[model samples]
Target: ASSSSPKMVKAIRVHELGGPEVLKWEDVDIGEPNEGQIRVRNKAIGLNFIDVYFRKGVYKASSFPFTPGMEAVGVVTAVGPGLTGRQVGDLVAYAGQPMGSYAEEQILPANKVVPVPSSVDPVVAASVLLKGMTAQFLLRRCFKVEPGHTILVHAAAGGVGSLLCQWANVLGATVIGTVSTKEKAAQAKEDGCHHVILYTEEDFVARVNELTSGNGVEVVYDSVGKDTFQGSLECLKLRGYMVSFGQSSGTPDPVPLSALAPKSLFLTRPTLMQYVVTRDELLEAAGEVFANIASGVLKVRVNHTYPLSEAAQAHADIESRKTSGSVVLVP
Candidate 1:
């Protein structure tokens, strides 16, 4: 594939961190790998709010200039030393890392990638890898949403939220999701949310209490952070799990551990990387995602697709919540 292509490729890299404007679409030379790596000619990129955190300088693990996409689907062009199973021209996809996406070609660790099934399209692979694994870790690994258990999820129309609804629905849990608007509420219902709360017009804490007949829920997945933190806590049943995964509405303030005393709630903020730390774990978790996708129980919503050059606009849409479900960047 590298022999078939030219020199420089257009990439979305950040020159500075502030807003979507920092994501500049410019020509960047795709480099060959040293060893234990491969150059992937990316065809599709996944747009996530975590990218917004990187762009906003809130999550400052990055240097000045870097491509900020965690997941993509592409054909391998150059394979490095010691890797035999993944060869050139092999189709693959990956998530769970950062600082190297939004470009035409990205060199990544060979072990980090998984083979793309011929049954799945490149775009679907890209869209599901990161967020699907996230859902996999959340319900399947983190707390294990079982049948007859009820759960509350914030930002129910967002990327992982969409998948969580479907996955949990299949697991037979009654899912109550919280959204900011009527449209999002409706979308969440379509995604298998048993009940949707319009947070902007509804008191979510009260609604959760009312929805469960004052029993709250077994688990509360709070990704909207600070704004929903307290409400999330109050909405859980005794011994319920509060999973604070992402800070989409900005980071939550420090909470006293004693806050859990009233209900004996369990608090855990799990990340996908931790659950998939080893090659075996990565394969098993991703295999669960792929199996569900192939079985059609997991519906990945690539609600919008933006050309690589329009990533700034894509970020703007995500920041504004103008687009719901999942948004993708097509190269």
Candidate 2:
């Protein structure tokens, strides 16, 4: 393919940060891959809370009127010059930086993507790549969850949370999950959560204390920022790891060093990008995730999906806490 011309495509563009209305389905121009890049015609786009964060201005974007997406599965419609092992019609998926996957077609760095297993559906691949990789590093690398280690996951029924519960259970850990409603609690239990707490009606910290016989959890994965951050610390055992990966509710206040003195808590806020900074790291993480999906070790739930044009409604549903499992956008 030549890089002399640009192609017009339909995409979800956010001109200014605000509500879901800001996500407008409009036309945009995308150029051919210059070098070390491939043009992907997206089959399915992933919907994540991070997308919402970027859309709402909670996370800064480098430019305005930008497409909002980070995960997608598609085919290599065109490969850049001088690139080998990738050809037209190859199926692939990518997650993380250089974020622009909401369009019908996009130009991506060739190395950022990995081949999707033939057995996995493109929609499922799109649904799990980002969230599954997040779960991978969190359970296997971040704290190395082991048998007899009791871990608490907030928003247990979310895209990443569901994968965490299932993978942690497979790793022989006792998984305790917290959710807002009974329906989500059931889903969490079905996802292998040993215990499900409805935080809306009960004191999660107290429940966790009782479940662990007052010893507390080895690690607390808190995504619901302000509302659950402090309580997550309270639910940890001495020297426990407090992993705050997201702030779906809102960012928590700054922590005082004194906050960790009582439990000697180890607090870390990690992102998937930092965990997979190199090509080898990217392949390793993606390989593990795809292998798990292929072996049935991880079961992705694409419980909700919307047309790419209806991304606004999808965002509204997720932000209002009305959707569960994974949400994907069909192109």
Please report the candidate that would top lDDT against the real structure: 2
Give lDDT per model, in order: 0.88, 0.94
Best by TM-score: 2
Give one digit per residue, the lDDT tens place, for model 2 in 11-122: 9999899999999999898988888999999999999999999999899999987999999999999888898989999999999988889999999999899999998989
Q: After superposition, how far is residue 191 of candidate 2 from its true place, in Å?
A: 0.5
Task: Please give, for residues 227-284, the per-residue lDDT of candidate 1 as tens digits.
Answer: 9999999999989999999998889999999999998889998888899999999999
Off by over 4 Å in 1: 1-7
Error of 2 at 76 (Å): 0.7
Write down the TM-score for model 1. Answer: 0.96
- The TM-score values for the models, in the order shown, are 0.96, 0.99
Q: Which parts of model 2 are misplaced by more than 4 Å?
A: none
